[model samples]
Target: MTKLFIATTALATVLTGAAAAETIGVSIPAATHGWAGALNYHAERTIARLEEAHPDLDFVLATTPDSATQVSDLEDMMATRGIDALVVLPFESEPLTGPIKRIADSGTWVTVVDRGLAQEGIQNLYVAGDNASFGSTAGEYFAENLDEGAKVVVMRGIPSTVDNERVAGFEGAIEGSGIEVVAMDHGNWNRDTAFTLMQDWLSRFPEIDAVWAADDDMAVGALAAIEQAGRIDEMFVVGGAGMKEMVARIAEGDETVPVNVTYPPAMISTAIEMTVLGLTSGAPMTGDFIISSELITQENAEDFYFEDSPY
Candidate 1:
């Protein structure tokens, strides 16, 4: 009778453990750009850590180049994988909304990172960096450092809500500051295009005081053009998205690229962790998770430095 009771208890424990293990699907945009590449890196690392910590839980990672493909990917993941939860960094907002909403309606937990969905009341959680604050901080820095009336050039990223918010914030901060924006152009968040645009701007506006590229990759190209032109006096460049190389510049007090604002790619990790907590610990995480942006300068560069990071 005692042996039978022990055996029954062991079987019950096994069944409980099996029921606790949940499968999570993580879908993100492909690593076509530096920021997305960094997102992939952080997502992979978070998965590894979470899996080791909770041996029963399983994680699936998927990436696509565009929104339509990502929508398809999400559907396939749901149909074939039997995912209990989802963590997504959408490529774009509109095309992804319907498919993601469908997944949410199927009772799978959803955590949306960075780009938000067009349709509301779907995602269980939302995570993102403060993009508007990123631009506003940079603009404030430029205004304080330069004379009251400075001519500046702006290089924009892809035409998304994120880009528009940053531009609006920067312009709002500098309003009535006596700073004139000499030229503004879309760089498509590409280094080559930014370099070409900066070179053209230099030729067009000889009295430009500074360059703000909104992101580090474009800032690198702009920096290269400024170097090649041999125009270093009273010229400054600012960028965001805490790329390692740009953070290093801040640490070294590089005058030309003196400062940066952070929109770290690691926000994906935050989303994943939150989703896990929501599923396993009954944590109430069903709300927007907006991360803060900070200015990176020589005094505070070490805090943002990650030696092993790819971006």
Candidate 2:
């Protein structure tokens, strides 16, 4: 009779109480670029450690290729996973706002990472590297490092609020500078796309002094294009985000990559850590956590380089 009772209780626990487990859902973009790749690595590592540390905690980690699929992932998590909390890094802000807001309305704790939603106040907590600071810092580096009459080309990322802020901060800092922005185009934060754009620029323009590829992945692409065009000696590249490889190049004082801007992908780990704290501890996570972006030069780039880092 005792054995029967024990079996019955175990069955009930499996069938009905799993939803009662403390579940956290993580949604982020697929690793389409170097930054995104690092984000994925840190997120998975964090989730593994958290799950081991707290056996009762459950994690549902999802990656989306685009905004539309991300919406479906959110809905699926809500419908089937019984998530007590959600941590999202939006693929695109506007398309994600409504679905995320609906999740919040369902009483799920929401912590947004990196890119924000189109609508504000939808998330209970927001954690991201300061986009404005990233841009201005990169811009200021140009203003200080390059010549007054330098010819620089701009490579932009996808259309989003973060991108806009980065561009605005960069432009604001370079105001009245003798630096001429010869060409501007959206690289969509993709390496191949930036390669194509740079190739076109090389073919069209006889002289290109410098290029700001915005993101590290784009910078790599731009560099390849420059090498292929045999313009490596003519120009230098400035890329944001402290990718390990990029940081290493800067640490070695590579002339082509003299400096990089810090926009670490490990910010995803930060958001996950804070969200886990909010979930486990009595203190809830609220308001904004903006990470500062800084310059990575030869003298300081060694500090940013991690030998075994995935990115």
Per residue, candidate 2 scores C-alpha lDDT tens digits across 155-206 of 9999767789999989988877888899999998889999999999999889
Q: Which pairs of residues collide in candidate 1?
A: none
**Alpha-carbon RMSD to native, per candidate:** 6.1, 5.0
Model 1 Cα lDDT, one tens digit per residue, 1-311: 22442353356448776465577889999888788888989998998899789766777788898888888888877886678999998888888888899999989999999888998889989999988898899989987887877899999998889999999989988888899998999998889999999989888887889999999989999988888888876599998898999999889989988999999899999999999998889969899999988899999999999888888
- Taken over the whole model, the C-alpha lDDT of each candidate is 0.87, 0.87
| Candidate 1 residue 123 C-alpha distance from true site, Å | 1.0
- Segments in model 2 whose C-alpha atoms lie over 4 Å from true places: 1-20
Model 1 RMSD to the real structure?
6.1
List TM-scores for all candidates, in order: 0.93, 0.87
State in Å the error of residue 191, model 2: 3.0
